[model samples]
Target chain A: MSISLPKAFNEFDEARQKGFIDVKELKEKGKNIVGTYCVFTPWEIILAADAIPISLCAMSDEPIPEAEKHLPRNLCPLIKSSYGFAITDTCPYFYFSDLIVGETTCDGKKKMYEYMNDIKPVHVMQLPQTTIGDDSYNLWRNEMVVLKERIEKEFNVEITDENLKQAIKARNEERRMLKKFYELGTLCPPPITGLEILKVLYGATFKTDKNEQNQTIDNMIKSVMEEYNNGVRKVSEDAPRILITGCPTGGATEKVIQIIEENGGAVVCFENCTGVKGNDTLVNEDIDPIDALTDKYLNVACSCISPNDNRIELLDRLVDEYKVDGVVDIVLQACHTYNVETYRIKKFLNENKNIPYMSIETDYSKSDIGQLQTRISAFIEML
Target chain B: MSISLPKAFNEFDEARQKGFIDVKELKEKGKNIVGTYCVFTPWEIILAADAIPISLCAMSDEPIPEAEKHLPRNLCPLIKSSYGFAITDTCPYFYFSDLIVGETTCDGKKKMYEYMNDIKPVHVMQLPQTTIGDDSYNLWRNEMVVLKERIEKEFNVEITDENLKQAIKARNEERRMLKKFYELGTLCPPPITGLEILKVLYGATFKTDKNEQNQTIDNMIKSVMEEYNNGVRKVSEDAPRILITGCPTGGATEKVIQIIEENGGAVVCFENCTGVKGNDTLVNEDIDPIDALTDKYLNVACSCISPNDNRIELLDRLVDEYKVDGVVDIVLQACHTYNVETYRIKKFLNENKNIPYMSIETDYSKSDIGQLQTRISAFIEML
Candidate 1:
């Protein structure tokens, strides 16, 4: 059965068609646009600094050719395409960005930021890899302070503790709404398809207005919950409930989701750097806002961190919560950290958790779609 | 003029001939042999626990084929060979190790440790990637504590503070002697060849007898200083004084050094992970030994760390102190961290110091020997 998207969801598509009309409108209204590469980039700080934060992670094959001129052909397609968008001037969000935020989450993106710096003002946030030490927390907090100072200096705005608290609250509400929206997937015959959820999550990255985004998420949640309560399922109940994990899969690289859905599998949850994992935790408001932000972000189980057992813990929690029958880990080409972590992930899933697992290594090209489909189909069959 | 080899140098070769006689003898004497991969693995802790610490970083092409059976073909040769040695039971040092220490310095090595675990008892140390944070220091110190406990449990020995202090002293003496030895290279027509220095450095990794090593170093230092005082240079003063940097170049991967020295360049200093940079700093004895060890190791400036400005600072000091003319950054294939940092290293050297820099990317294979020689020759010509 074909499902109709909500009006708010259609608005996002229309905005994309009109060259990200919302971002353009925000820029025209004298608001500073800050393009970010990872969720680790403090969006709350940008919001508090009276600037709009939009994720600039590209997922298109279109920009790879342009990006190859500046980068090695073997780099992650996400990085290459992102750089391509910047160099080729295909991304209006990047073109209109007053400042761009980059983090040292991975080497490929970290070095790519240097090149990105040539085209735009890039503020690099030096993220610490380990999360368990006081030194890491203090170092990360200091980095956040440095970032705040830079943002304030550039935007000429005071990001007071009160401002941060307000931003944190707004962001927390958005996260709560997102959490609720994802909960619908846990139902037998998930009410909302994985692709539909991806569209909403992807749209939130570029949407500047958190309140409007929350409202959109609420509407999506309402629609999905209604369907679930009415016993209207998007996919057959027997379809394999697959947990999607690994490197960030933005809107441009949702082929895995499409392939899974098309081949008798439904993605129940995403345990990746993007989507719910990025915004799952809320900043603790009781302590110093900076410390809270530092704690929350540092605890984010990015594979870039050593002893990333936290990621496995999160995956375990998600698997049980989403009732996942199998896991599909997609590692973008040249994403060394995620690629390496796949061994441990597979070991944990297959041996310990008794969940079926498959790792897919691919780039942002259509060449591997058929092969991926075959493998995914086999994985579903096993589940 | 040909330089006569020191008798002490012959002992290392003899030990190698006898299949790492020092390591074998230590094992025979009932001393627990702890094999390590990165400098980040605290040797002092192992020494404090009454265990002999030896580096297990392999740089041989022979075992790559064996390693490929368990690992991907595109992995770094160092990791592959290291694992190959473990799986194929080739290296005697690995065979004699009671426990192998692996640090998460890079993804390839980290994942390889999992496979190595199948063959031997592996203690994986979670290394922090940033040095700036209190959290990182605390995390690292705690890890050191954990390592100490593990060593103590395995060896049935209490590593007291006194023991740690004594270990630190012995290790510091080795560093000082090594430092003095490297200092001789600063002289015009440097007193020693880079290859000779590499031999001494590589030997130290597995040689547990600190006093003997120190004595050997003292004799070498005295000989080098005598040559320096006599105005007898190892290489012509006109030979390009080059500094080697980037990934650790163990004894098995000394091709770059040989290529540089054979072609008109004398390596005045090594700023890489394996040489002086790895053991340059002495742990502060005044403070808590664990804290001091944490500080020293964290400051090692491995490219694995984010915002690795310490590496640049160290390079600056080495260049000025050694009176270096150019830099040759050798990055092993599939070693992503150091590979990415080359861009920044090149940018920093060219823009800030005006130093001529060249990056050589190769594996532990003879295929690239001619290409590396040509590049080194060209780099020396430019200098």
Candidate 2:
């Protein structure tokens, strides 16, 4: 059963054009809404607090004049995008209801939040920059506890263990299906089409309905298996397998995969927030769901969203699991946190794993496809 | 007339072996010492405080093992150096200082202050990352006032306006003479040699007696003028005039200047905390000296210290005053603050003026000669 993506909430472009769940309607229905920059780690719980529909306000849209009011022009594009949304009447349908939240992914984001909150009061917390280390993990956990209390104080909504558990259950189901999608990609010659995987993955996170998303993912998985069984997919036995690391993991990531494929390579696995995180699994279903969800989300930590911990292990696991022959660390300029950490990853891989690694730097205008193509060709040839 | 740099402190290698100031002696002498890293705008005033010595703890020394205990490996080197001195007996003089002051130069330095304050009590203040607007300048001014009070409270010393004026007078003389030396470098077939000027510049800063240092500078200037009048100097007329900008205008800066000169370019002027700032005239000598110092220092800010309101103007002035042909922005890899501001300077120069600019990123390693040479040669050829 191949389920179709719901027309209401599809791709980011479509959502941007069609407008997200209407703020006015939610206001009329007495549903409070809060806006955020990125879909953060503790997002499901934030959304589940009956605090209105939590929407991602990616700060990379057209420049907003109002953002320049609060932030310097050199600030990260994501910050500018958020400011643009905040000032513009574009999201009049989305309730600009309660408080906004900012997470520490990079210094730019962190500084932007500081400047933003100074202008307009927003509840802010510093997330762990890395996903590794018990101290870092606990710092985030403690922050979440404080954050939960702050949210409760602001919205006057009680977020009990039961409500959080329900949210985690939904998120975990989405994660499982997303994981299945990733496994399909790891299959020799990749049974599922990259296009189908992109749509299914995108829908898993952006879809308003959890059950429908799960259904869509299941159908996509079944169709991929059927296609594999029918032997209709193009299989490249000699193609070098690779894993793409860093941000811009949506359609931007596909470009990287396409480049690799064009250079006689195949992207077998992706460990990015926007890539396969929708398929992340639940951690210890028998345990407290909040902890489980935190663990699961933490385990699927996005390299682009925050500084990744143990990228060496992540890459090693991907290499072993997906039979990867090379790794491409695609980072962006102004995204210094990832850029610095990637060098360490490169050093580690070079010293320990004998893996061929190349780094690609992208800017807001990732329109330099020729440079990227040349780099990809060179990287593939080296591999 | 030339002041000989203490043989021990003549070169970085010798200084490393001779060791830094004795922090233990500083504590015993009852001299209120303020530990500072990089160059803060108000540090001159802090040093001017009665019986207080502002020990600039630029992170240019040996690998800071002690600082590495508390700070992450990738912290701003200056902060690490300060922390290293504070915890270790290596630089016992600066280590046992009465207080440590750190500013919000970058995220790492900001975090290091937090970490230090949390672990060991220290004074920390948020400084504006950029120096474009009045609010930013006023914030620094107010910070200077608060810092003044805080220093008084900690050291039990009255840091009067007179003392600050005296300090400024002495510092300005030092700066004026240094600028004069730089101006002489701009003379076609420069009258004074870079090595000789560097020795005197590095020596004059650490000299305890202010009047004697001025006398030495006067003598050096006279010698250079005499040499030029007689046409005895052999300076390169075809050399492109270069301006050095960055921190710790010491042996490393001198080395860079030598490299540029050897590569057929001349370091005609330097816009750095230690190089250009000592000459910033006291705005109101009759008024409150501390306030005058604050206003004056803030007026001519160094990118390595604080953001200045007139950075582009500063560049233009250097271009006009010293007749510089190019700007060489030298900053270390982890120097986030200087790196960002240098980029700003580069962009500003590119837009406002046709002066060629080159940015050199180093890790304070002496072995970076190859990288420095390549960039300098290319830049000189372009000029």
TM-scores for chain B, listed for all candidates: 0.96, 0.81
Task: For model 2, report DockQ.
Answer: 0.05
Q: What would the per-residue lDDT of candidate 1 be over residues B12-122, giving only the tens digit for each residue?
A: 545444447767777888988888888788889988888888878887889889877667676688888888888989899899999998887776776677668878999
CA-lDDT, candidates in order: 0.81, 0.60
Task: Report the C-alpha displacement of residue A243, candidate 1, in angstroms.
Answer: 2.9
Model 1 lDDT at residue A19: 42
Candidate 1's DockQ is 0.26
In angstroms, the error of model 1 at A361 is: 1.5
Lowest-scoring 10 consecutive residues by lDDT in candidate 2 chain A?
A4-13
Q: Each candidate's DockQ score against the native complex?
A: 0.26, 0.05
Worst lDDT 10-window in candidate 1 chain B: B1-10
- Give all TM-scores, in the order shown: 0.83, 0.55
Q: Which model scores highest in TM-score?
A: 1
